[model samples]
Target: MEENLSGQLADAVAQGADEADLARARAGDEAAFTRLVEPLRRELHAHCYRMLGSAHDADDALQDALLRAWRGLARFEGRSAVRTWLYTVATRTSLDIVEARGRRALPADLGPSSDRAVLDGNAPLTDVAWLAPYPDAGLAGDPAGPDARYEQREAVELAFVAALQHLPGNQRAALLLFEVLGFSAAEIATMMATSTTSVNSALARARKIVAHRVPPRTQQRTLRRIGDARVREIATRFATSLERGDADALVALLTEDVTWSMPPLPNWYRGIEAVTDFAVQVPMTRCPSWRHRVTSANGQPTVAFYLGDDAAGPHAAWSITVLTLRGEHIAEITSFLGPDGFAPFGLPASLP
Candidate 1:
């Protein structure tokens, strides 16, 4: 529907001036509506993701926001920039979704770190609100706005998103609007239908929790410091080591306090010894075959792996592992094990 309307909006633009397009859009021209919102789509979607912590949830919230914006377009009095108004709608919609469901979480949030690997792992918890990975493809990486605190990529990093989930819905919305998207406290208060004092208080509380949780340097900054070629080299080395079941090679890539966690399976291992022991027992000794392709997730390196045997034919989809780096060393490995992560990468069900 947006595509069809966008095409019509293009035709309308070809016919006249900017004023004409605005008139058409206000008069319910779907094409004009599309044109008005298209420029803001990516940022708005990102806002929803920050508020909700799941790309899937962000999609739903964004769609609802657009719909509401369309219906309310006639009431738009030109008091604020269209972008600001749209964000207001998107933020409110995300808050609604948060109320209905809840914030998503990582496995580490569920319980203490396992000293040893839980051999069979645990069953996939359907009811557990697990944090979903974001696909970085097609993102423009543009800054949110002039006053935005975080770059587009920085806002989506795994650590940042996970920390956001820890805040309450209102505080989360307030912080994103003020710090991430660059809205002023007074402006955000208007958007949320509250006082500036309340918005400021929310921002302060949200920042405290996030500051406590997130690492000092963002993944974006670290990736830039390392450069792209070195980033790929590190990810490729880890994948190759895993495929060959080379425990030593794998350990060589890890930091002394490296951590590995496979969500939906509550157990996670911390430190070099625990991680290496888990790797040797499970992925190295038990899994007969492995294949991998390097990918990106949350502005950091990721590896999508397949596991099976030669005789059984093609390998089956396994995990989408995202590595967290502390300089050149692999600090954390979040292998999102399940078919759920496979689809986002467009991976085949089996590899022959």
Candidate 2:
């Protein structure tokens, strides 16, 4: 099978590959090139996603970077490891994309959070560049490198990626390369065409901004502290409460300061009182039937919900709600409303 071949090739590369395949790849052998870079594709795509805040943008950036690498592979002397060189190319490519398009944002960034849920959800903001959810299924389980400050799962948490968008492009790249990808200052300077001191300065500023925006601990660490079974129990209980229209049960699981937001809808709520009111009025009362399957997204517990009544046919895909926990309680709920999110998680389009 293809997977077996890829595993064999990765093993071969790990044991020490010769210059033969590199030469073939440089000479325009597509299969040879595929073999050479296959091991790194997942992580490279993740890096692009982190930089751009959208999976679609990451796909384009990664494709462009790979094409550039193929064309320039011949010029690659024995200066650096292939992984580092590819990352340098990918990082610069992402920077170029950032220079043109700028950062992505959520509804919260557009304006202040509404104290009460807007009963009539605003028109979907098609024009705004919003952050997209990442399907955690495809993540590379290993850290980018040994020196990475964050674990692989820790780096891709929703809050971390959202906070990253607040930083400028150069600062973003510097911080990612240093803290996430584990590139040393000297190496990152070479990639960014800047001095080590400049890289350090950028990293310091980026870190300060990120620290204030992101929580003190990462979701991955919190999940580890809670254990998988407890996290699943919370997700299942929340989903069941919605299905039964049990507002009290839902409120019991949420923190006093729990926040809820639905993107594209531009309506959000903070605190248990506001969230409960929104949940009862909109989700529970409006939608008559509910079905949910537990899933994970952006390194957090999530539910893929379907809503409909017998008169309307099968239950249709509704939203993918990602939960942010503060210890045992749900601290934040980002319910990304729209059926478009369903396919990525391999969820059913309709539940009978």
Candidate 3:
């Protein structure tokens, strides 16, 4: 009887061992994958988000990377470890989505801008499309120990993203791969299935184009050193004035030459007076009880405003407000709130 019992106990242990191997094989070991991915997820998401420029697309791309990781686990062969493989999958997928013309998207909040808008009689704006903004809060680099990421921060601002739209796709990919992702030209060539010479040439051309587009943020160097509280106070005041429908007060806070725009909308009002005019005419006239929740969005200082309150919660985080401050005054306001934006901003679709 004792011998028989011991045999049964041994059989049970063997079964448990078999199950463990099977679980590992399935890539169904959630705890292990979590540990593998946790460290790099946020940064990876940022890369994908910048590449795609939509939070929803970034989320999807991340999910796709995860699934691909699961499927390709056996082939991982420990050559590059999990992280690099994930990055490789991520970049290829982002490039594929971009190159395939399959996953291109723009914020639903912003509409088209007028070609004839006067900017010092600037011959109608040539860049008509709306590019989404990124919040500075999500930047992967350290904010302290200061070489000052002035250029880098400006590079991710709402305005720069708009400039990136003008580049051809491959140049865009190459520039992002080299500059933002910190990948080698040879590595990019491997990823793109091209020659090093080809990648280098593309990088040079991309640099030239982006150089012309990136206006030196002559202000950012001094701007970054300012205390955070002082800046937040100014932003808060502007938010309060905006919520009160007091355009005069809002205008008082804005620079005389401030540029105001809403994505997916054709009208772009430049100068404090013009912006004030539009502010008085729209929004305040119709939407009442609009509430702004301060949150980091699109690598900038942003507020997610909800237009109306439903019984359960706020419905559809309407607009992500990106404020560009030059000293104490706001210079550029870009509100990107297009259709289907709630998901990207991590907001609920409908209030209960």
Candidate 4:
């Protein structure tokens, strides 16, 4: 009972602080506005990434949303918490972007997988808006909400975010707000400026679609089961195998149904045979040398690859390869090619 009372006291204190900040913000104190929003920015950015598949797009959407909130501060009637108000602004801003740009896609979504290694100089699909990886560093420990269905990191999983791209803007917003963020139906209805019935319908449709696409088990669960040391060993072995051009070593780590995709390259290979063919023929053979740094993306193990022609020469950034594992074996390898993905992860442009 004492613990419960102490918790209630903390909440009351926080609420009072927020009220003071809100009043100052409303009176055109920019510093107060910054103070009010700074705490929520990271989670808000993650929310934007879920809404829009690309972290770059999320950056823009969040900036625009914050600007909108700052301009409309006078209209914010203290009826709801500041976080909810910011989310409402962010969600609506993201919906507008979704409408204008449409959804991002992975190479697998474009066409059927190639049965053999694509030897031809397959050019990157510059025209397509491809899905980008999220840098999930410092995000794993933060709590979403007690009522949230998906954990904070689970919501940003590549498969989950990619599935969200398949949803319509309204349905996507409703689902993220209700399921991932744990906003109530009535609250979502208000945020979305729609009826509760409409929000319910959207949520139902969104859930059905997401359920079909997303895997039954989340990467977080898999990582926990595998343990941190083992997971690191797997990532290291995979990266080392690639760097050493050890095809046999690489093949040993993969599941029979493993998939290999390089986006914005249109061709993707599925199954061990096809993936092995592609790996041996391309990165292991044609590409001269490779250097890698293990990283994390979308709550999955990742490797940042750098390629160089001369073995001793500086290797330039190549792809951010995100590995999706099923048990001890890797089930999917999504290598998001090009240097654009490196900066977000704070990866160096080249390796000496």
TM per candidate = 0.91, 0.92, 0.73, 0.97
* Model 2 TM-score (2 dp): 0.92
lDDT of 1 by residue, 1-352 (tens): 9999999999687646545666788998999888878877877877787788777888899999999999998998878877788899999999999999988988889888877767874677778888877778625544566788888788888899999999999999998888888889999999999999999899899999999999999888888999999999999999989778899999999999999988777788999999999999988888888888889987889998888885356888888898899898899999888776777666776688
Can you tell me which runs of candidate 3 are displaced by over 4 Å? 1-34, 77-81, 102-130, 133-155, 218-223, 308-316, 338-352
- For model 3, residues 192-228, the per-residue Cα lDDT tens digits are 7789999899878977876786656533543566556
Model 3 TM-score relative to the real fold: 0.73
- RMSD of every candidate to native, in Å, equals 5.3, 4.0, 10.1, 1.3
* Residue 138 C-alpha lDDT in model 1: 29
List the candidate 1 regions with Cα displacement exceeding 4 Å: 1-19
Error of 1 at 231 (Å): 0.7
Ranking by lDDT: 4, 2, 1, 3
Local distance difference test, each candidate: 0.85, 0.87, 0.63, 0.92
Worst 10 residues of 1 by lDDT: 137-146
> Number of clashes in every candidate structure?
1, 0, 21, 0
Candidate 2 residue-wise lDDT at 326 = 94
